[model samples]
Target: MADIEIFTGPNCGYCREAKRLLDAGGYAYREHDVSQPDAQALMRARLPRARSIPQIFVDGVHLGGSDDLAARLAQGPL
Candidate 1:
């Protein structure tokens, strides 16, 4: 089993969708709410270039945002 991480914000629809897709696919994930101070700091440290919510990772690899996930899902499993 691979480790999955997702950085999210409370009001972010894409973040919700990302989680939804993960649930639908039966992929377990650790979610960090970047809206929280500590989580925000950690997210910035890990993904300095991420400009939006729903920043996702699998086994420690950055995987962009929700649209990126959708495209990847289209291809196959994440």
Candidate 2:
């Protein structure tokens, strides 16, 4: 399995959906809640122009948000 990271904020619907997809796909991931101060700083460092929630990374590669992840999943397995 690949190392996965999900950067998200509280009350984000996309974040929840992303998590659900990962769970259903049987992929483990590290979730960083950007709503927290430390995680927020980390997310900003990673994505300077991230004006949205649920920024996802797969094996250190940026896979974008929930929609992006879903699209990737739709194409094939990661």
Candidate 3:
């Protein structure tokens, strides 16, 4: 099992999808809502290349956005 971290924002379908996938897979993760104060800046500081919502990290390793996560899921279980 790996520690998962997912960055999210309000009303983002990608965010919902990411959470949904994690839920379906029974992956317990830390969720960071970028809509909160300083969250966006925190995300930027933590993930400089983050260009969108639902940026996922697996055990501190950058795994990218929702589509990236989906592709990874298609490859195999984490």
CA deviation > 4 Å runs, candidate 3: none
Candidate 1 or 3, higher TM-score? Answer: 1
CA lDDT of each prediction against the hidden true structure: 0.91, 0.93, 0.89
Model 3 quality (TM-score): 0.90
**Model 3 lDDT on a 0 to 1 scale:** 0.89
| Whole-structure CA lDDT of model 1 | 0.91
| Candidate 1 to truth, TM | 0.93
Candidate order, lDDT descending: 2, 1, 3
lDDT tens digits by residue: candidate 3, 2-78? 89999999999999999999899988999989989777888999988768888899989989988998899889887
Highest lDDT, which number? Answer: 2
Q: What is the lDDT of residue 57 in candidate 1?
A: 92
In the range 5-67, model 1's lDDT, one tens digit per residue, is 999999899999999999999999999999899999999999887778999998899988999
Q: Any runs in candidate 2 off by more than 4 Å, and if so which? A: none
lDDT of 2 by residue, 12-37 (tens): 89999999999999999999988799
Answer with 2 or 3, whichever has the higher lDDT. Answer: 2
Clashing pairs in 2: none
* lDDT: worst 10-residue window of model 1: 47-56
Per-model TM-score, in order, reads 0.93, 0.96, 0.90
